[model samples]
Target: MSEAEASHRAIARWTSRVIPAILAGVAGYGTYVVVDRICIKFLYQERNQPAAIIVILILYFLFLLLSLWSYIKTIWTINTDTGLVPLTRTPPSRASSKKQSRRKKEGDIESQPYAASAAPDSDPNSPGLERFYTKEVFICESDGRPKWCPDCCNWKPDRAHHSSELGRCVLKMDHYCPWVGGMVSETSFKFFCQFTFWCALYCAVALATSAYSLAEIIHEGRPMDGHIIAAVAISAFFGLFTFSMTLTSWRYIFLNVTNIDMLKKAWVYQLAIQVPRGTPSTDKYTTITYPLPEFSSPQSPAAGVNGHATGPTSPVPAQENVSSARDQMATKTFAVVRTEHEENPWDLGWRRNWEEVMGTNIMDWLFPIRKSPCARHDVVESEYAMGTLVNTIKERYGLDKLPREGSGGIEMRDVPRESRRSHRSQRS
Candidate 1:
């Protein structure tokens, strides 16, 4: 590496190591001051309550251990599953290579579709095609190409984003947090949440105990101990910080969204419909932008792939004809449009989403030792955001299903009845 590049990497390594160490040192020192200096040395000793002091010390140590475990586990998970390691396709086995060579010699290889270009022939109805259609292959919508990460020299997986600081793609990345000295991602999210919770809990407990002692000192008109003052102030500040962090983390978990998801949504409109170059001209078609209704009126002209309208209909077509035409139009339109936010396929529903990331076992939910269901699988299968609510609304509107492309491209006005009810409920 060049001197400048080497210097940059050295700085990153130093910061990543030093920041977390400093945070840990501060936390450890504050805990020691509160429990040993204030709670035990002053409060418990003054009251001659040796048993209470011992119990408090034991609990303090237990919580401190748990916090350390969570922090370490979060860091470990991020390191292992950040998608930084380039994944190249495995080479064909010798037997397969020989067979391919024979086929080539027999002049039959030319007729075979390239593996990169064709769907698997073993199963014509393979779910792979559906995955590609849904943008789960991490293909770029701008030009129908796979999104390549130059830093990693690999194709990015769905929902994985490149982190400039880390110089790699992180799967389902939330953000690079300086406080944690690492990127928060799919594998580490649960642990990160647990860390925040434990940190806040520890700080709050310390603050409560220290505040009590401080109050006693004031009531007796005695000078407060310097250690007690320091503990109370540090605990109060960190307690609020960690508590807010915990709340924010849980909010995103509940919504089945991430900070990155919100950021991507801000530019979702840039993904426009792209028509194939050879599409036939339709004089009577309508070009509708995405976020269209689940079902348009029969009189509404079919939209072209280019978001243009064709000429007016000659007459009322049969119901079946209208449905078929609409489906065809939708399919063509969807094929060309970028799938960035086409559907939050990762959102299964509030309950399922929570269960997937937080674990079904109540104990596991409360702790960070056990792996979450989502962590077991590399790829996360998702559905629409608020899927249950959306389905209920669609059924109430006599719409049998969600939009063909999952609720990403459709408009709220297309389903006004559901939108109105949602609005009223929100207002109330």
Candidate 2:
């Protein structure tokens, strides 16, 4: 097996093996606690004590089974159901493959980047046009070179390098968390949620059963209240942490973007069908729309078009196919729609505007404790306003070219209103 595959097996094996052992340890502890409390403290050992002991034993066994079921289900979800795959599983686009072949002939590096081309000549009315959506994806530079997989023979997507350890491209991957016995994602989020709930549940059940025993112990002059309190406190803390993570993850899912996309400030673009301006087409006949700015400023995050979202107003049909390259190439035109990953207007260095919208003390509320000097007011304000410093981004968004009150700013040059109207009309 390849190193990557071997790593994956190791991960799977450790997870499958180590996790069960931990669960067994927890079960053993629970048994010791239950037996000590019931047999030594709670059971009276009088003539009628044996009957009460039998009833308690039956209930304890039932509770243990329920706890085991929840634990097993959580482990099962973590080990499977997450849509991870090896780089070998990722298929390369034909264009990427051709590029690699040509490069190899010239004795260049053998690997190809993970991206597909935009079909500039495409039919807007064709059903097969959505493949262009995948074409926009680009590997983020922050992620290092992906391990070369014999199956893929190309570079993998961003945040998706081969884990010689896991042998799969983990979805919503952070790191391979061994404690839970596998990779992390929505599935693991749910698993953690259930695990926390089960832990709290067991804690409550244990405490309640032990309460009467503890009362007797106190009557007999032993203080065990501290142990019960400690267990309860730990349960509360774990529950809160697990619940908060679930909500944050849900926000990322709704945005249709990943955490990496937010930090890097990048946009995905694809070539699409071209059409004549001022033509109306239903989404069925309408191909995926793409945006092209006249000029995009490298320095500004806010200086790009805010592309609109797309979806069918009507129900879509399955098994639809179109291959009329001639008709597709002729009638369609490209337009832009911003991905959900686009930086918000507030993210640009528009501090006054941000303070106005989010309120004067927004930073304090958003980031409490103020632990890092880098996260100070001036730094936050500057990074947020960086895009507004550029004139191109401001003009594209139809904002004022220069700040009305600033002294160190550019002067506005006048153009004929008629020429401005013509330019605006052309854009439409």
Candidate 3:
């Protein structure tokens, strides 16, 4: 390796080792201030109040140990050495066989589904996941080609995103988080959320006790202990931080979304339609946008390889394919404009969404006792987001006239309504 590359690696190794020690020291110091300064020092030793100290210590240690255990579990869940989080995998994580894990060991993150582009017959070791392909495998374009990630040189499935940090496509990757020390992705997301939750409670208790003690001291016209002051500042800082984190993490999880998905909400979702270059125009076709728009949409594009322009702000390039469909017929791409509310097609409603990431059992929540359900290529038919997605697909391709895509001629609106009813019934 080059000298500069070696130096960078060395520095990274050193930082990784030292950073954990620094964090552990901070956690240890906070624990000391709460248990030693507030609980034992002032309440028990100075005031001789055993019952009060006992109650406070019990509560304090409960949150503390729970938070610590959760943090460790989160770290364990994302362990780079073990391929704890997914690099790629076929089966849902909770159900991954030992042979499957051995084959795709990197994929152990949350319960969200991940369908590998690898066909079952391509690799001898392939676990049979049916190699489900989404609409992405066809119409989506980058460099005028369908392969989603030019960097990874692969056709990514729906919900899979290329993580420049990890240098590969992550299945349902949330974000890279340093606080929990890894990618808050499909595998480790639940552990990370639980960690934040327990930490929020821990910090809340720490802040309350320290602030209460400080208030008591001031009210009595007594000086504050330095350790008590330090504890209060640390507790207050982490309390607000953890509380906010817990709220945001669970919010995304409950919505069955990742931070990446949130960022791409406004990007035009386009599908390239290929037809013979001399085909007659069909631009009069109309799209019925959901919560249907206040104004009607512009006419559909004339069938061509690359010609019709989209909205002024639309990012769908007025570019042509140099490969594939361009070898014969022309291509006509359509932008399926969706309102912000309907953008996410993965939302399965709150309960299933939550269960997808965090699991459905008490022990699943209480402990890091199980893996999250791996993301499936095929979302359940009852999912609201799935309905929105299927609805958009139906509208974009003029499937309204063709009954082959779905059952009967149920209006697209009926799909989400049925899904909503399903959610309501299960919720009830």
Candidate 4:
């Protein structure tokens, strides 16, 4: 198999393992909950003590904490090893034949290349460049030939596309997010971490509070209205919380892809469409001779292949360099070593806040969106952004109507509502 395919397979294999583990954990927790319920009944009926509830609550919290901790550690690595943060340096090196040093100096801050490209160099009458940055894949140039692949969808932004992990094209594409929910955005990551802590605490508190109340009811042989109200209130709170959590997890699962990886996938798909089966990409696509936009010397190219120079401002020549530069090598993406400081995605201040409040006994209000997936407004805003992306794609790619040769469409208002709805449902 080609290297890229092999790497994807490896990721799939590892991710599959996580799926089973999560499933098993869920099953285990269900079993525990059931057993605890039964035990509580027995203890109250025969032993006649409130301690039973307390004991069960402790055990339940312990298990919840354990599961949450494991998930946090695993997901955190994706952000750390990948370019989720500024990535002052390159990301960590994966196992591969083409090994190279991928470090960077501290304080070399950078953002997505597209973000910078969104600003105009000098034209006053010209619209802001951001209008062109789309979330869907499609050809921008009318002269560009229709190179469609059944396996992949057309992305309008050219470079902005989707990663399989993230089910949709992301702005300033990075990589797929794999946390139980999805991409590790500044907002989402914070919620994910908070969700972990709060979930454990919530579970513990509910369990303790419930058991104590039940014990009192059993011992007193009376149903107090206040006790019953409290129970109902707790249940209501949990139901709402669970509803929100489910939404967050669903978002993660559907769009777990990143901006960087989106381009990589789109690039590979284009190459695949152009090349015949069994054909390999040239050395240019496989090896990195320079750093990426987020890590290159201000004067240097974004990256290179096999020691060849690839500048930052310009893309590798599309036609001439196709043969010698990016020969069909099969590998589509490369991971490089990056510095820790450059990798801070949470904004400098947020990371500091995380370090400070993490594991501390602070007022819960201090971290409002401390649960996974953060808040609903953030989710809604992301959707709104996606809507804009769809419109951009329609403008660039000529929407449902195929583009005429040598011309690309770029009218955002032209996209059909049904198509956008269809894509949204696909994600849902």
Best by lDDT: 1
Worst 10 residues of 2 by lDDT: 297-306
Backbone clashes in candidate 2 total 25
Point to the candidate with the largest TM-score. 3
lDDT of 4 by residue, 237-263 (tens): 644564565455434323442334332
The clash number for model 1 is 20
lDDT of each: 0.56, 0.39, 0.55, 0.35
Model 1, 263-318: lDDT tens per residue? Answer: 65233311212233123323322222222223332111112212443222233546
Winner of 2 and 3 under TM-score? 3
- Structural similarity to truth (TM-score) of each candidate: 0.61, 0.41, 0.63, 0.29
In model 3, the Cα lDDT at residue 155 comes to 44
Whole-structure CA lDDT of model 1 = 0.56
Could you tell me how far off, in angstroms, the CA of residue 288 lies in candidate 3 after the best superposition? 23
What stretches of model 1 exceed 4 Å from their correct place? 1-9, 50-55, 85-140, 150-153, 265-343, 378-428
Model 3, stretches more than 4 Å misplaced?
A: 1-17, 80-139, 142-147, 265-342, 375-385, 392-397, 403-428
Candidate order by lDDT, highest to lowest? 1, 3, 2, 4
C-alpha lDDT of residue 44 in model 2: 52
lDDT winner between candidates 1 and 4: 1
Q: Indicate the TM-score of model 2.
A: 0.41
- In candidate 4 the C-alpha lDDT for residue 142 amounts to 17
Off by over 4 Å in 2: 1-16, 39-67, 86-164, 186-188, 207-219, 223-428
Ranking by TM-score: 3, 1, 2, 4
